[model samples]
Target: MLPKRSISKSKPSKVWSYFVKSENGGKCKLCQKFVKSSGNTTNLTNHLKRNHKKIYLNEKQLEIGKETAGPSNVNLFNLEAKASTSKAKFPKTDSESKYSDINTDERMDSGSEYSHRSPTPTAAKNSDVNVVICTSTDSQSQSFVSQKGRKRQQRIDQSFSDISSFSEGGNKANKVTNAIIFMIAKDNCPLNITEKVGFQYLMRTVAPSYHIPGRKTISNLMDEKYEVLFKLMKDKISSIKHFCFTSDVWTDTLNSRSFVGVTVHMVCENKLLNLTIALEELSKHHTGEYLADKLSNIFRHWEIPLEKFVAAVTDNGSNIVKAISILLGKSKHLPCFAHTLNLVAQKVCEDDAIHEIIKAVKQIITFFKHSVAASDELRKRNDLKLIQSVPTRWNSTYYMLEKFVKISEDVGTVLLKFPDAPRMLTAGELQIINEIISNLKPIEQVSKEISGDSYVTASIVIPLQNCMIKQISNLSPATDIGKHLKQIILSEITKRFGEIEGVSLLTIATLLDLRFKTIHFNSPLKLSHSVMKLKRLIEESQNEIINEETIEEPTKNENTGSIWDYHMQLSSHDKRTRRENGKENNAGINELDHYFSQPLVDRKVNPIQFWFEHKLAYPVLFEIAAQYFPIVATSVPTERLFSRAGNIMDPSRNRLSSTKFGRLLFLNSLELIGIYNIQIK
Candidate 1:
């Protein structure tokens, strides 16, 4: 009903003083309501808990008089009251008080205490027999220090002090660090971010108290983080028995430097994992030997099991081909499908009709892009903005032409407004633009479908190539440009991939796909060859498994005493020796045969998931599928890594070391070991 002020002036409680004021009959600070000064603090305590629960829960009662305060502190006023109730139980006589200052230590043993009664007590019964024990071993004379007739008047205050320091801001510091790293990676900020006045100002404005780390501190932190993430990834790689790699070399022309990137792919627990395994800056020669040595070093460093290495996909460059062949054997290197397609598209676009149309289109787009007035007028006509083609990029020309078609009328109007503007495209040129889009559309679609890193793209290569060639053959030479385009594409494809390459690893990938299963192949001879290859591979794997089992459990020869038993054993051994050869010859032939006899998989089925569900039915084949399915048809994974590196090591930041550049690129791509997983301001 009332609030009370603590009497202990030497040490006061901040919580009590703050909530219950000493003015106006103990007014509550939060509610400003007057309470009766009846020496009761129930109302004040309730008010603080109800009105300001958040502050009340987090704030600790401060010790005003102590040199150092702790989290745990008992109320001195309450302890004194408990001591007074227990004083009457322990009484002392005058005789004990006379010798209270004698040599008590000499009379008592090693285990001793100064007081005979308990210094503090919480019950009435325990306080009656409370006494102090000595801690010395010298038992010269037994002398009592206190009298039995006198009650103990003085009380000894006891308090437990907590020694651990408070540092609850560690979580906040971690969050800030993650935010800084995220900004550096996502926005491609320089490592010397703290040195820049603008960056420092921005960070200070956002968080005034946050201590920004120096460049070296940040770099060391990232290096430490890299080791942690590498261990996790290394463990995952070690667990996988089979995997494939996609590698490529990227030339940064502005910096005149080249780098090699390798991406690792595998299926673990029915889910596909595509991760950038290596992105190394190459300062040495780009010769076959140099590249091969670099790749071998990385494989050895990561402990990549070469015995399980299936194949590698790279561009058609001779050095790359030779390098991959050296590392993974000659039969295992796959020329990047997307690069071959780019070349085919590039060659087909070389016709005079297509060239004239692309030139005019580029001129028109450049005019609109440069002249803001022209762009505004074009935007008013149609809100579509034109995209200029980059010669180095694939599918860029198709996109440029397609965008122009959408805003063709606007362009015609814009050109009419300026007499000195580039000449408008003729009807024939416009026709060529539409034809180019038609011819290149299929190439663009197929490129995207195969470049996907998450699923089985190799299986679709043969089927998709067959479909493209058939589409090109049906063009019927409707125009001069159409005939030229069709001829260029067919020649390029026939020269690069052809029929035989399809029946190679590409067909093996398709055979693994239950969805396609030899149904799309037109040539019976190639189909039979693929089936035979699949059977042979499976048989080899089965033999390896059997040989290992045999090594683990070898047969033993023991002699029998009876002549009849010995004769039977000799005959059985001869029969068993012949059967072993036959079993080895056809170790895993039936699994393939059984799969071929089954119905073809449906068109809409997911190949990876299908293999996963049916893995137990054909476990050996599943192991083979894991080896082949992750082989991406293109080196796009490495190319994408180069794209990020390009942004990081820009012309202005050319002085950035390769280590910093690679780490930044890696952090940008993989989100720096899951810094992006945290939601930070």
Candidate 2:
């Protein structure tokens, strides 16, 4: 036989004709390379069984479905093809009739038509994948229609029309609103602002087009998106574990005191995380109870159990202690030790001799500050020591003491060098100069002690170094008269500062072991209330609050106003007497707060095991305290949080309707509520 012409060589009309008889071959509809009978058909059937069995089986299912679908005359699958098809198109002429009768076996050999790409008869049998549903074309109707088919059609069509109208119309917006939805979903690519353009731009591009507005429109959209982000951020914060709060209210340049409360929260770790959670503007009229109530509500909203709170740290204040007790449940108070020591120095130095000594030293300092020549002369002296400057305040008291130690000898030398030095040495000044001279050995000793093995509290060295005198009662002085000074240092060091102040929790701290055994100051008659009480006193001191004073410059010409500062106007009197004649019981009570706050020395074996190893966890201890005392100490990490919150949700851009602000507090405070742990941060 002549080599068979390739299907590609056949004319299109011949190929169509050849396809007719080949349909009778009963081959597998797909992979039509084989005939469906005898050897070839058996192999083809096995191939379908191995590879296309499910698809082939589905065709069989559709064939049966077609058969059962009502009647032969009403084939639903073929309805569309049949509805508009004309019966008249069948051959009607004699030539047409004769061609229809020709034998058709040879046409079976040709397979070109079976290999074409049109949807096959078998494919049409499966309707689900083949069904082509149309969408609605109307978007002018402003309503949420549920039909996906209708909406898709309307949206896709309108997008183009919308776009065309904007670009085409130029002056007006299209009927439909053009916008984008900024969203934060729970999965991949969690947050987004789909710069979706409206109908005007959609219609312009043949394919779907987006409308990007002018600069102002972009800015407005960005602003809106920012709002969504704030809500999410606010929510994320509210979900944190617990909240820790730290707050401080102080005088500003205006002399108006404002209370700023910051919240710290726990995020992924113990490492301090988010701070900008809640930065509540505490009203000046508010009391501790009001603060507690406000703070309690925020904690309640976050669902962080308030009972777990460690303690609320505050600048010493009683009302705040009371409020923290009420809100977070008692045992939630931790007085800032930093402030407590300042007041201690104040009470201790208030004695006539000590105060005058300090003033005399300061006078020498003033003399030098006033005249650099004197400072230079003193600095050049062999015995003079230079130390860091310490600002005076309760917090600065420790540092100021250290500063004085540094330049003390220099000052004394300056006084001795200048007979004309306005600051003449008085008896108290002499005592102070003596004290200043006495400090040289201790200063050198503390310098060495600072590096040697620590005994009681390392926290003290740096802080004490900052103050009136370092190693006040720690190291024994080697001077011939240093034995007395050494006794003073040891005796005071023996007294537990925390016990003296009444912070019971500090027993676990290093304050428990301080050895205060000096014979100079007499012991109290009876042990006083908890040292924590003093902490409370310092915390809650609002008695002489300079409430909202307007600070202004004093008049330059008035002696009473400018020339005479409160510090400068006070007359210096030499009253160095500390007589113990008949005032035995009230030795320093007339000038001090009250009785001794230190815990009495306990004479028991295993005091460590005896004191600690209580069956109760630390948190449990607070809970137990709550049952008895009205207040509880807390950590209140919130102070750390709100600081970070301000930056993250920048106040300028992170605006919210007040309701949202509360939510922001919840999110940030929840984790920070680790204050719930009853441990110091």
Candidate 3:
């Protein structure tokens, strides 16, 4: 066996150590990141002043040390200053260049706080002259090493061309949209979703240059770039106008604080020009007035001119309405006519006689709905038509009122035409039918032009004509019914203790249309139910939030709502129960549940709410927009920029400064071929 070699002692690491020659010509101490101040510290000082001038420093000592830092003293900046005389030596490399290795070594050291770090070459190798090392303990800096190995320059125009069941989209979206998303997460959506779903899908469809990563990549990216994406989006959002505002804030089933959301929508020049998201977090003691005040402050910060506001719509919450009043100096509200009509029908049905008629009609409807033969027979009776009549159910009660009248006539005319059809009889039933038929008489030709005798039809025609005229008379589509709804909104009246006009007119009109419940002193259901509904709506209005921007949507690129409704549709994960996604994930990451479960106000209270509250309202607004306003908007132009943004900065390359995101969006907008009309090439 060979004799064991003697162990040799190795030198200690000289990382922070520097052999500085003392003024007495003796070595004093060593320092790592710091060395002698040459012409280097001068540039560093200037850079600090320019870049980090406002950043926090040990200011307590900086001012005092400034005067003492003049010269001569070994203690400058209250720290030892190394002399340039004894410069440290570094290794040399063979390239036939003068101290080439030494230059590389110095360059490597340039990765200090004193330097602006540039992206290091990916192919670099560790060596005496070209060592790859990181000084900071920050884990983020280290991730770059891996990016070099995995990242590829996105096929700028084909990012989403071949989504292997996946892809992505937007304008440096990771940077621009992420910032917006981050801000949203802070207040509205807490779902911890790093990648947007609909946008991602749309990216694959619209912009061919975007692609979503694999699932594993997405999960990892979520962790790393969540913050980056949010900041980027926010930065991009900071510069826009005419934003569509959508707000849905709610408490848990527990009914806690008022969590409000403010989303801005601007579809300009045929693109979704800007979609900004904001959240208004309120304490439990929040009120309409307090909420309005806070919202006013935020609007002032955004430079949004309240005068330019085309509309401020909200769900039926009084508080949100108050906020809108604050957001848009004042408003002439438009309430949902459909909702009012529902109320009217509800009232007319409340009468005992009308109630019996409704019951009888509904039963008859159900009977025919359940029987295809009866429905077919009714259609055939209406001039011998097809196999079936659409709307076999009673829901189209108004139109059905006319159809049922025909059915009754047909039954009476062809009473023995079929055995399956039920016979019409009974004095009481017939009397009720007479009332229903009489009310519908004038509109139809059931009776002769004058019946040749006035008194013959006075009992029916007088009341029916008055009801129809009254119900249809007060209707002013130009005025959103909800404007004077306060008279009917119990909460508003109770809380304010004020009387409202148009209440009786509205109620009587509603009764004529069979759209309202009878509100009589003798009723047990109580008047408060109606008021409670109004209260609920006002309460919801009191808690709305939204953002706005100015961009017109191009009719050519307009979204007629695809197989998936992007803007108007809710995110699927909006199910309130979903908090955290996978187990063992970072804590507080899964806040999406808070967003989906948020309480919403009624559309009646807030005009915006009317469009978002019901499917009918949304389409109604679309029709109104298409007809009244130039349906082609500039909002889509802004969305295209956002789409471009998401394209540039995505999960794969998430981190980005806000400034860069804005610049990219601006560039994309200028390059637009067409926003209003789809351009050829």
Can you give the TM-score per candidate against the true fold?
Answer: 0.69, 0.35, 0.28
Candidate 1 lDDT over residue span 199-273, tens digit each = 766544333334567888667656644543454356445656777788888887887888888887777666666
> Candidate 2 at 417: error in angstroms?
6.9
Residue runs of model 3 more than 4 Å from their true location after superposition = 1-286, 290-307, 331-345, 349-352, 363-681
lDDT by residue (532-648, candidate 2, tens digit) is: 433343323221121211121233223666545554334211111211232322222321232124343443222223223431332222222222121112222333334433433
Give me the runs in candidate 2 sitting further than 4 Å from their true place: 1-243, 253-257, 265-279, 297-305, 372-420, 423-474, 478-681
Residues 1-681 of candidate 3: C-alpha lDDT, one tens digit per residue: 999999988763221111222232212111001123342334333333332222112222333544653222211111111111221121111222222212222122222333345544343454322234333211112222324344333242332322221123322222223232223322222223326765454333332233334435433333333332233233333333334343434432222334444434442222332333333446655566776676565456455555434444344567666666666544323222222323344443344655555555556556566777666777676763212223322224444544555456664544355565555544455544444434333233322221211111111222332344344334332222222221232232133212211232122212111112232212224334433443333233222211111122233235676865564334423321232332312111122222223354331232122323442423322222211111111122222333444454455334433433333333233212111100000
Question: Regarding lDDT, does 1 or 3 come out ahead?
Answer: 1
- Candidate rank order under TM-score: 1, 2, 3
Sorted on lDDT, best first, the list reads 1, 2, 3
CA shift at 140, candidate 1, in angstroms?
A: 64
Question: What's the C-alpha lDDT at position 357 in model 1?
Answer: 73
- Give the local distance difference test score of model 3: 0.33
Task: Write the number of the candidate with greater lDDT, choosing between 1 and 2.
Answer: 1
In every candidate, how many clashes are there?
A: 21, 108, 138
Cα lDDT listed for each candidate: 0.65, 0.36, 0.33
Worst 10 residues of 3 by lDDT: 672-681
